[model samples]
Each structure stands twice: as C-alpha cells, then as structure tokens.
Target: MFSFRNFNIADWFSLYRIMAVPLLVAFIWFGERQLFTWFLLISYSTDAIDGYLARKLKITSARGSQLDSIGDQITLVMGLIGLWFFENEFVLANYQLILLAFLPYVLQMIIAFRKYGKATAFHTYLAKSSAVLQGVFILWLLFFGPVYWLFYFMVIVGVLETIEEITLIFMYKEWVEDVKGIYWALKDKRRLKKKSVKNPTS
Candidate 1:
C-alpha cells in the first residue's frame, strides 16, 4: 500500500525507508519488548539500503533527501525519547541526564538545518560511524537497561564521536562554506526585513 505506483524496481528501497516508520512506531508502542529490539536493527538496515539504492540508481531528489532526514530523526530521536521514558519507568537514571545528552544533538540538528539547508550529507565515513556507534549505544542501553558504568561509557563514546565530527567538518572545509552560506542568507533576510519595516508598500 505504501510503495509509489510508478516504479517496478528502484522504488523498493524507498518504500522500505517509508515503511520503517510505522514498523518502528508499532514496535516501540505496542509490540513485545523483545520485538522492539528488532525495530532498531530494521530501521537502521533500511537506512543503509535506502542510501545505497538512492546513490546507485542516481535517483537522489530533494524530496528523497527530506524524507530520509525526517525518517532518521523520527527513528533516532523518537527512539531515544522512548528509551528515556523507559529509563524513567524503571528508575534507570535521572531523566535529566537523558536531556543533557539529547539537547546537544538536537541543537546540532537545528544548526545543520539552518546552516547547510540539509542534514550533513551521509557521505562522510566518520559521520556514519559516529551515527552507528550512537545507535548501538542507545540500543544497548535499551536492551540491557541502564547502568552507571554504561552511562559513563556512553558519555566517553559520545564525546569521541563529537570530536570526530568536528574534525571531519573542519578537515573538509565545508564547515566554513556552510557557515558563510547561512551568514549571508541571514544577513540578507534581516536587511530585507528591516527595509520592509521602513517602507510598507515596496
């Protein structure tokens, strides 16, 4: 029911990425606890497949890019939220700790969107590795339940991943370009807003 009606072959992977949403939701919401574990694995698998197929088929479109970003956010962010809730329900950790780790990543997403007009392209190897590590850490925490030591381990890993991203962003010089683009766009936007305020008709 979900597949786009036009393609016989290329659409299969796109369909998979779309399908992962409800599957993930169902797993987290109503499925057996053990089954929810599969959700993470499947969602990530589809992430890989969709990316590969999009590049291999040369069918990358703006819509596809947006869809992929939304899908990823839904899975990763929502899953983390779910884990945070689970932690609360079980008295696993202070809910505040989850917020502390989560907020930075949320800010990163917002900054990337504002600056680059897209989520960091998935093409960077270290970025992908960082994502995978983050996902694994979250899943492990979910499955094993939280431990104080595990929390420390995750913090260390998370810091390392952040460092990797910072290094990679600078290594490519795309960071400067991203910042410059956003700076110019915002400056122009603000100037236009000011002019509009001064002259109502023009």
Candidate 2:
C-alpha cells in the first residue's frame, strides 16, 4: 500500500497526512498546542486538495481511494488525540456524547473488515460532509473552544454517515469504492450486475 513507485501527485498529497502523524505527535509531546493545530490544519487541507486533484487529473483508482481512506482515518484519530490532550476538560464533559457518536463508526469498521478484509473507501457524499463537519468541529474546539451547535451537528452527521456506510456494506455484497449514497447505489450497474450474475435463474 505504501509503494512509492505507483504513487502519483494526488496519492502523495493523500500520503502527507500519514507522514505528518509523527510530527503532530511530537508537537503534542512538547506541549505545543499552537504549532500542533497549525500543522493539523495543513494536514486537513491536503485531504481536500488530494481528492480534487485526483478527480481533476483523472488519476482516480482503487489503490488511490484506499490510500486516501487510510490517511483520513489516521488524521482523524490523531485529531481526536490532540483534542483529548489539549482540551481534556471539554472531552471529559462530553465523553458520553462522543462515545455515542463513535460507537456506530466502530461497528461500521468492524463490518467492513469482516466483509472486505479492509476498510470501505466508498467516499459517499454524506461521508464527505461528515468528514468536513468533524474536521471543522475539532479545529474549532482546538483553536477556540467547542460550540454546542457545531458539535451537535457534527455528531448528527457523523452518525448518519456511519449508518449509511453500514447500509451500503449489506447492499454491496462485495467490496466497492466510491459509492455516492443509497440513491446512487440503487442505480449502480456494477452492484446490480453482480446480483444478476449470482442468481441467474431469477
């Protein structure tokens, strides 16, 4: 997955987040909240840049999607760690809410791994929205503090995205990437053809 020979410009951009992880951890270790937040912002920016570049350049591929998803997951985990370290009181105060929002995501991961032997990189529109809200909410908390409305919206969108992902898992039967959402899934010829192939008698 980390093969440099096959990586393109956008893949390298996606890889930036994973490569930044150790530096981010070091920033936290030295108690450099400002530096950590700044670098974290840069990391998040790469997420948008990579995706746009991939589509614009027509360099999208299964490998690229998987790599991007890996980078996103790493960045999110590190962001939450940074939040817990810098905003311990806030995290503790909202621990239950955070856990509630995270539980379904955990379940989705488990389901994906069991079905596909890896994580889903569906990149649905809802997933994109959820990622944006999560990054915004975390950055807001880190830079200033939590806004109740933002946090609530983030949690709601996140849970909905996870539910959609779980639903897609069952719908696909086999692992697929870049599904937009259920509406698009219903019209997905790839999925429909797979079903037809499996039950030809029907």
Candidate 3:
C-alpha cells in the first residue's frame, strides 16, 4: 500500500526517484550525456538519502522498502541504458561479459516474484557493494569513459551479488526485508519461525 496521504520525508525521496524516471529516460533519448549523468547521479544519491533518512527518523516500513527497491531497479536500468547509448563501442566490446553477469539478475527477479509474489529487499552488504560499484562504473563511464579495471570488478561483484540474492530467495519462504545476507539469514528468527510453521513436529 502507498500510505497515500501519510508519506514521510524519507518516503518523499523514494517517490522522487520513481517520479524522475521519465526525465532520465528523456535525457537518454535526447542523447544528452552530461544532463543524463548529472540527473542520474542525483537519482542514485536519493537511494542512499532515503534509506538513511528512514533509519534515522525511524520511519521505515514495508511500503517504503518496496518503493525504494522499485526506484532502485528503475534508476539502475536507466543508468545501464545510458551506458549503452553513451559507450556503445565499449559495451559492444564487452557485451558477452555483461550478459553473463546480467542473466542471473533476471533469474533472481523471476524466482523472487514466483516464490514470494514480489521482488526481494534483502539489501545485503554484497548487494549494496554491487550497487555502489555499478553506480560508480556507469557514472564514471558517462563522465569519463570505460575503465577496464573497474568494469571487471563491477562484473564480478554484480554476479556474486546476484547469486547471493537468489540463494536468499530459497532460504526464506516469504518475502523479507533488510536481511544483511546469508550469514545473517542463518540466525534469522523469521526464517526459523517459517520453517517451524512448515514442520510442526520438528
């Protein structure tokens, strides 16, 4: 649910990212490299801002997490689109590796929706690190150009993060929020509770 009339300041930031997608897309379509990079940077920064504000103000909720994840996915796709447009030759050169890292990501989304009726929001540390590297790699490519070292590192982290997310999906029956990663999941009472529910005699 949107909490229509009750959105807090942190929620507003998340909403901004969602609402700004059209603008980001427009920049890409118009071939406005600098404009796209600047606005995308702002959009990416809001991801961090919203999360910090939610925690600091104690305003976190399931709705906020969902909104935040949707915003993140959209903004990231927009960034990748921008990368493809601005750095065509570079992307063309490494398209194989890109697809290799990207396929697992798509699979993870499919599995999450099928299993829990929604995408995940585990927000694991590995996931966060991947996001940071992705943002840096894309923005750096747009602002400067492709840095091979960073590109390889981003791909490795991206694949690892995708694998971690997919693993977590199997670890929890229902959707979860803010699960640090698989290690934290091992100690998660929510997972244990759900398991206990399934095997009552155990």
Alpha-carbon local distance difference test for all models: 0.56, 0.93, 0.89
Question: Which prediction has the highest lDDT against the true structure?
Answer: 2
Off by over 4 Å in 2: 199-202
Candidate 1: list runs displaced more than 4 Å. 1-19, 55-65, 89-97, 116-118, 146-202
* Model 1 clash number: 0
Best first by TM-score, ranked: 2, 3, 1
Q: Model 2: C-alpha RMSD to truth?
A: 1.4
lDDT per residue (tens digit) for residues 106-198 in model 3:
999999999988889988999889988999999988998889999999999999999999998988878879989889999998565896799
Q: Model 1 reaches what TM-score against the true structure? A: 0.58
Off by over 4 Å in 3: none
- Compute the lDDT of residue 163 as modeled in candidate 3: 94
- Residue range 160-200, candidate 2, lDDT tens digits: 99999999998887888899999999999867578678879
lDDT ranking from best to worst?
Answer: 2, 3, 1
- Model 2 / residue 78 / CA error / Å: 0.6
Encode model 1's per-residue lDDT on 100-123: one tens digit a residue.
Answer: 556666666666666566565433
> Which residue pairs collide in model 2, if any?
none
